[model samples]
Target: MKTESLSQLLSFLDASPTPFHAVDALRNRLNAFGFEELLEQESWKIHPGSKYFVVRGDTSIAAWIQGTESPSVTGFRLIGAHTDSPNLRIKPQPDLNQHGYLQFGVEVYGGALLSSWADRDLSLGWNDLPEKQNRKNRRTLFFIILNRF
Candidate 1:
């Protein structure tokens, strides 16, 4: 992992108010590494050493790093803890009228000290692609399951 790129991740997350925006940040970073963008509605043919990504809707994100083996079962070790810090989010119908100040409606995810976020800047990333209930809706937006570190 590149330390410079990894360090910038926090700031990038801070800039992305939503997960979709976060993926956009990641996409740019991955482009530097020569990864190709996969079409959302296109078919995928998996092989060795081919990196690709997909977005589901608006909330989730995911990606994969290719391995040399044809089956690509190269396992080394999973280092580093996956961390998701708590922060604020804009309400679906959010406005600045509440408290006469601009703020976000944040819900704590996993296990975090919610009180601390009141003073800290937050960074967010996305993962997972779950099936949406409505099939009739055309996918103007895509959800991504975070796959790249």
Candidate 2:
């Protein structure tokens, strides 16, 4: 059971290249487990035994389980986590050429072990949504992986 859980975690990390992607991944799992999405701008109808989530700017998310017991007597349970991997990020106008060799301008986003990344299969992920759906849809994620430096 531990091995299965660890494998799932590694898979999740591999799939989530960015914080936004990570949250979306979590949202997908929550949905599979019967959780529903809640919009912050709208009125809420929370009930016991129901699960719901709300995302802020596609970068952060909050999820909860509404228990049957009143919070005044039985307090709520809260679990929190943050996702941030020390990795490279593509800069705006990412294309570059050095000595006639094409390259992508990448900036390190966190405290990454730069030496560990040598010869690894690397990829870039992106999400493109229409302006109108920026407040709703999340099916526009895409990735572009470069095989060579």
Candidate 3:
């Protein structure tokens, strides 16, 4: 059982490239475990002994179980974790011609070792969300892993 759980965890980590992917993965797992999704924009009609989750910006997720105990007497249990991975975002005008080679302007967004990225294939993930919808319900997603040079 432990080995199977470890393998599943490994697979989850392997599949999660961006924060959005990670949140989506968690949502799937929670759904499999009988958790329902809740939208922040809508009014919540929470009931006891029910499990629900909410996502924000496709990067943050919060899940809860409505136990029988009242909030004034018994508090809730919170298990928090974060996924921090290096990301590079392309600038508005990313097209560039450097030394007769096409290049894109990029800015790193996390604690990443630029030196370590040298000579390594880089995978990039991006999502475009509509103005009305939060990042949780992204309209389009692009998962791209650059070929090794």
Candidate 4:
């Protein structure tokens, strides 16, 4: 792998802290490559030699490029990938005051290595929904590191 490619990958990882953020980053990249976003509720008119993408529930995404040849003549090729990984998720009521220390209640979302996470720097990222129905949801990323004496 080239240094430039590695740098880009690191940048992508840094930008994507949650599944929603990863899908958004992917959508932006696809848009830059001439891919049109298709909504699940809307009708789609797919044509040959065109690029199209669809996002589901703001977490999953699918993008494809149509070939000039028919499906019967040239078989389709599909690739599968996931943006989710082992991580901790904050609960709805995460604030906990224990022994004069303010802590957050978190749950493991996947097969996270809890032992490995001890004394390591971590960040919290989430989609903040607005109170107004017309307003768009905002993405917020916060970083915090706890050190033990």
TM-score of each: 0.49, 0.80, 0.82, 0.83
TM-score of 4: 0.83
Runs in model 4 lying further than 4 Å from the true structure: 97-102, 135-149
lDDT of 1 by residue, 1-149 (tens): 69888878778865555555665666666778777766678887766677766555544445676677644465644333222344444446554556677754655455666776556544533333345876534333333343433
Clashing pairs in 3: none
Clashing pairs in 4: none
Clashing residue pair totals per candidate (backbone < 3 A): 16, 0, 0, 0
What is the clash tally of candidate 3? 0
Residue-wise lDDT of candidate 2 within 4-110, one digit each (tens)? Answer: 99999999987798887898898899899999999888999988988899988787889888888899999877888886678888888988889999988888888
Worst 10 residues of 3 by lDDT: 133-142
Better of 1 and 2 by lDDT: 2
Instruction: Give per-residue CA lDDT, model 3, range 1-149, as digits (tens).
Output: 99999999999997688888888889889999999999989999999999999988778899999998898898767799985587677888899998999998998878878898788887878677777746444556668888986
lDDT string, candidate 4, 1-149, tens digits: 69999998898888788898898889888999899999898999999899999988778999999999998999999999999999998899899999999998988899998999777766767775556884445444344444555
